[model samples]
Target: ARVAGFGPDTVLLMVLPLAHNYNLGSPGMLGAIAAGGHMVIAPRGDASTVFSLVENERVTCIPAAVPLVVNWLNDPALDRFDTRSLTLVQNGGARLSPELRDRLRKRLGCQYQEVYGTAEGLLNLTRLNDDDEKILTSSGAPICDDDEIKVVDEDGREVADGERGELVTRGPYTIAGYYNAPAINARAFTADGFYRMGDIVVKRGRYVWADGRKGDLINRGGEKINIDEVENLMLKHPALHSVALVAMPDPVYGERACAFGVLRAGATLTFEELSRFLLEQGIAKFKLPERLEIVPEFPVSGAGKILRRTLREIIEAKLAAERSQSAGPRRGP
Candidate 1:
């Protein structure tokens, strides 16, 4: 409608990948069209182009990823654009760190909302009304509104509040069965019908909080270490640039924590230094990595995710050689 000279409120801007649910401008445009609103599609979204569209088109709402929104707020060219027209800005994709979320809320003065969803089925959203604490703490409540969420243990019973368990959700709109795959359907659903999310969640008050995936949890001996917590804490180190924590097979402990990370330019760091730092910060010794691999760069997927599975394979191969060399030749006579 902007192309046809429609009013400002009639426009909605999408800055994410069009193929993504957040940016495709499908459901968002649907609401806009019903209200006679216009949808402005950004073929390629960047900090410069996005803010320009917001100012020129008077775009009121934007559904974007957290990293993109952070880039916009920190952009040196922010003064060049007039974004007073923006009322709602939503962010998703990954777990938004508490520090970044607070900066966006307090420093940037934007209405920051957090959303949690999977490409397949389950979707949850955190309302804007919640304080920054809630926004960063919980992944928010179920989006289905009336959906039932239960955190269950191996015995298939609901665990007590704050205890971690596999998340099982049941709702009307939830996908009842996988399409054209009996094998998936068999493992994806519970005997009683709730969808097995595979990811773990904890109940805090009334909200169900995501604890990453079930398989991703690192078991160091008898202790279970949350990789997200460790990764978040590692990122707090000033010398560190990026970090990905993956479980490496261990003979004595079943599986141990291994962190693959990059350091800031011209900054020299060591596993010894990191171990002391984490211990000083009150992180448990078991959670401190048994091995730290310093890499120049991480291997990221097309979607910009650090492929942990790939990284694990590389780490395994390197460690195997080290162990074999230490053991020496069996040898002899």
Candidate 2:
């Protein structure tokens, strides 16, 4: 409620289900009671419906998921509606790609706030007046002054500022246990009690930016590849609407990176063009995607996070089929 800038005159719009525990709705349903505001729940979670509600109700703020934002950006009718009343658009429940964030800023012409949170409890947010670099780069500072956080290496030793490591936290509101799962809880929490977020991140002062999950890495031979880093660069290609980088099995290298891109409306991009763009971005030769798959949309988890595992499976199956075809039909005894 405090971080959302909710007040007596604020008009907050809710597009996701009320059951969703996004930071925008910690309690009191968009903090209407906590801060004294008006909350408008959308009847249908569609772009047109959302735009209409925002325009009619004079919605000042909306806390939404990545997919809703993507649909709004790609919708042709977007310009026809008036969203000038919007003061802020908060995105969470999934990563906000650089390209998507830029588009949202330009299209809505409002403050775009990003947050990192989970159902288990920790929350980080970029303030409405934060500098462009902080808002666009780091995930922002913790919501509470006493929220204890630590970035540590694989050995559980705290890493230096700006060094990539896993983020662990134990705070006033953060849960100490996960109900009845003792076996799972043992590995999920540290010996002393901090909850292991399993998120690879870089911390500087109170600001932290997540790279991806600890297991979300690919090893191309002996070289370690950060999938999110490569995907961020690939997303800059003009023809892509969204990009997902995942691993595909290889006989020699063990695993290789493959890119899956959803094309922008009326925009087509070839693998050669994308590769050239990534190279021009100054990425290393080893980070270039070995294979490209163009799709209409990438699979997403129930929480709206991109399901890279599903994408990896898709690409690996495709490779297997290609290999089988190349070898031709086998003789049957």
Candidate 3:
């Protein structure tokens, strides 16, 4: 509210899940009511409905995660709607791709801001006025002025700027320790009293860009989906020796889970069968694998740890090829 250009007339529309940490979906509703501006709630995020709400309600601002924005941009129906009232779009939770950011900025004629935050009390934001490169490239600086951050190696020693390390933070609002797990608490906090974020980050210029978390958790729509837990269930397929879960680029969900695996010799099973097998396990629908590929082997490094990022790249390349072929023009007229 104290921002120069923002005022009582700013209408905020929120469609993110209300229960998720980033939800503040309704907090915007409260802000709108206090400022005497209309608050619009989108129970579910659909492109057509969102565009309609924007036009009908003259929505001036939108709070969304990267996935929602990607889906909206890809939807062909977006061209049929009017969204001129949209002036500002706030994207947070995960990194927004440059392609998506440019599409929204050019097509929507709005300023886009990228924010990085965690339910655990870490927050960073890229200003709207920042260059498109920075907005798309970096997570920007700390939100609160007093927030202090450091990137440290395994020994708890600070690393030089531009080097990748685990991000540890100290701030007034930062959590001091885990609630009841003393074991987790000991590892999650440093002896020097900084909360060990376990997030990989790098310093470039004056901003910090979050790479990914140290733990192999799949961040889908702000919800932490444990990959190992899911992979264990997938291996029960009998035809599969072992499986590794990797995140694939998703225009709608920010990232969707994809499984890469080695099938048992002489075993022939379709993806549908594998999916049904997982469904029977009663995992949350969102946690189910959206795409699955059978590979001869899993990539392993010198230390024998699975190279998940390498597998993710291989799956992404295959998916991209399929999409490109599908979108390719029809044959000779």
Candidate 4:
């Protein structure tokens, strides 16, 4: 937690499951203990309990996922609790939109740190002393001085700075190979040993900017739609609490963009309204989701990352059922 500016006086609130590598091995947890800081573990699924812990324990630092932060911001009980004691807020596991970052800073009155890391052990972090512009736009510089990062194309050749490419890294803490998974290890690492992180990123000077997962792109009639880009724009809408964009099967276009959203508590939004909002954001017409699904909650992994593959399966199955119903039984000759 020293890199994040946590100290012996810092009281940290741990809400994420300890089973996840991010929570178990994070500097926020280990460094806090090393510094003799107090750690309070909060119960899952209740935002009120978290707020109460922060207010009662005077929590100074919190490491959480982006979705949890979004839920806390959307909770009506936010204003009912005193959260001024919170000073350091670290978010990882998912991308934090510039809009959400600004809102968290203003509402929580805390310094927001955006961390970029992988389960495989590559870590990049933005410091607490970083300016708002750097914190909002870049995911921060590498944590270790000797850590190396490279953005490469399909041929494994490094790309120019500021150009988007798959991010690869090699560092002291990074894992060399997965246990008992030789097949995966072959494709997941380079000949020289850099791990392929499967994320597309752009390097601008000292900072790296994430552009979403390489496989998360949706091709709608040869046009590629960056899922994270659409989700980030959608999250800027006042009614949305969470959003996941996936590609749905479309016979005509081959594939179409579909957005699944969870509205804020007691808030209502229509597909037309959401589409109009995206249009106003200056996104291309083809990039706008042709279909919308309102979900109560998104399926998340143990690490708190949204299960977009599961969501795509749900929508594809529903479309198949609809098509089956539309086609009547064939009569025998």
Candidate 5:
């Protein structure tokens, strides 16, 4: 309640699934109860229902995903309802793109806050009064002074500020162990107790910036490309609506980056055009995507995060089919 600026009069609109910890526990239910505020649960997360509820309930805050905010901004029915009561829109469950952040504030006339947390530990959050650059660039500082966060290299040694490494944390609210998976817990937590977040982060003083998940790293001939960085760059293009970068199987390079994107309505973007744009942006040649697939939409999880694993599988299957077809049928000896 204190960190998120919740108050006794705050009417929080809960649109995320109740099963997720971000919604059922911290920030959503806990924040409201701690602040002595009211919560209106929506049956569905559709923009129409969410907007109408906000108008009717006079909701002061809402915990939403970035994609939902984008949908709301693009929905033609947005002007039909009154959303003047909304003061705070907190985003979680995924990295909120800088493009989306700017659009949210410009179109909604509300304060945008980004919360970086996991099911195991609720971590950083942007303050209400933070400057635009801090809100748009970094994921804010730790939730509390007591929350211990560290960015460490593979050897478990702390890295310098602005250097990317795995982020680990242990705090008052951080969970100690899994329910019944002892073996998994042994691998998940450090010997000292900090939960290994598996996210690559760069810290500067109090603030931290997420690069991508450690498991999501694309090792194209050991170049080590971060998929999140590529996606963020792709979002800057005016013709692209959404993008997801995944590792595709490469015979020589081991694994190459493949970008799947959704183009803006009635607009078009080709692989050559995107590659040229990345070159113009000063992106390193090694980090450029070797393949690009334009799609109508991305596969999303229940929490509204892009399902990169699913996209990788889709591309892998397509590649396998192509190879099989290329290898013509053999004749009897």
Candidate 6:
């Protein structure tokens, strides 16, 4: 409640399920309850519903996924709503694009905070008073005084500040181990008992900067293409409302980065055009999206986080079908 700025006067917008992690999801509902605040629950994140609730209920804060806010900002009817009531928009579950963050500040007149958390109970929050640079670049510091965290390299050695390494943490709120999952628990927890978060990050003092999941890093012919960096650069393109990058199977490299995008209204984007734009932004050639898949919306989990695995599955299916056709139905003769 304190970190998210919820209080008796707070009117939070609840577009996500209560089952979402008690750490950062549930629209700050747990904090709202602790602080004696009011909540407005909406069935969906449709622009009409969100805008209406913000106006009618005078919602003061919203803890939401990155995609929901992008949809709200791109809606043509946004200007029609009186959303001056919004004071804060806390982004979690995904990395928010830099371009979208600037747009939200100008258009909505609210503060933006980035959060890093998981069902395992680690939480990092950007303070409301953090400078523009800190809020824009790092994911913020630990929310609890008892939360113990560290960054370490491949050999289980701790890394210095600003050096990238895997984040491992354990705290009063963090679970000791998964329920009855010995195989996973053995690999998931450290010898010293820290829970391996499986995320690559850089720590400076108490603040953290996420570099995407270790598993999600695309290896193209042994060259690593960090999807988060590529996706942030791609968001600057005029036609994309939002973009997510995931690995697609390649015969030679074994894996290649492919981008999945949701387009802005009336916007048309082709692979060549986006390629040119990214190159203009100075991304290396290997990191270029080998293909683009446009979707009405990205597949989301119950807690409203993007299902990147599902995105990978979509491209794999398409490639399998292509290879089957190229093989001419396995030569029935």
Candidate ranking under TM-score, highest first, comes to: 4, 6, 5, 2, 1, 3
Worst 10 residues of 5 by lDDT: 18-27
For candidate 6, write residues 1-333 as lDDT tens digits: 788788899998888666677333422777888899888988778888888899999999887878788888888778888989999988888877667777887888999988887878888888989998777778888899999999999999999998999999999988999889999999999998899999999999988989999999999999988888998998888899888999999999999989999998899999999999999999999999999999998988876678999999999999999998888855556
TM-score of each: 0.81, 0.93, 0.63, 0.95, 0.94, 0.95
Report backbone clashes per prediction. 1, 0, 0, 0, 0, 0
RMSD of each: 4.6, 1.9, 15.8, 1.5, 1.8, 1.8
- Per-residue lDDT tens digits of candidate 3, residues 1-333? 222124577877777755555445223454456666666787567788888888889988887765467557656778887888888786765555555667678889888776676667767777656776777667777766777798988788889999978888888888888778899878878887788877788876557877667756677887767674577578567787556788887877778888877776688778788889988988888898888788876765431346788988898899889999999977886
lDDT of all predictions: 0.73, 0.83, 0.73, 0.87, 0.86, 0.86
lDDT of 3 at 62: 83
C-alpha RMSD of candidate 4: 1.5
What tens-digit string does per-residue lDDT give for candidate 2 at 200-302? 9899988888887877888899898998789778867778777788889999999888999999888988889888989999999998999889998978754
Q: What is the lDDT of candidate 3?
A: 0.73
Candidate 4 vs. true structure, TM-score: 0.95
The candidate, 2 or 3, that scores higher on lDDT is 2
- Expressed as tens digits, the lDDT of each residue in 66-96 for candidate 1 is 4465456555776688878776665666666
Candidate 2 residues lying further than 4 Å off, grouped into runs, are 23-30
lDDT (C-alpha) at residue 128 in model 5: 88
Off by over 4 Å in 5: 179-182
Best by TM-score: 4
Q: What is the lDDT, from 0 to 100, of the residue 81 in candidate 4?
A: 89
- The TM-score measured for candidate 3 stands at 0.63
Distance from true location, Cα of 142 in model 2, Å: 1.1
Q: State the TM-score for model 5.
A: 0.94
The better candidate by lDDT, 1 or 2, is 2
| Candidate 3: clashing pairs of residues | none
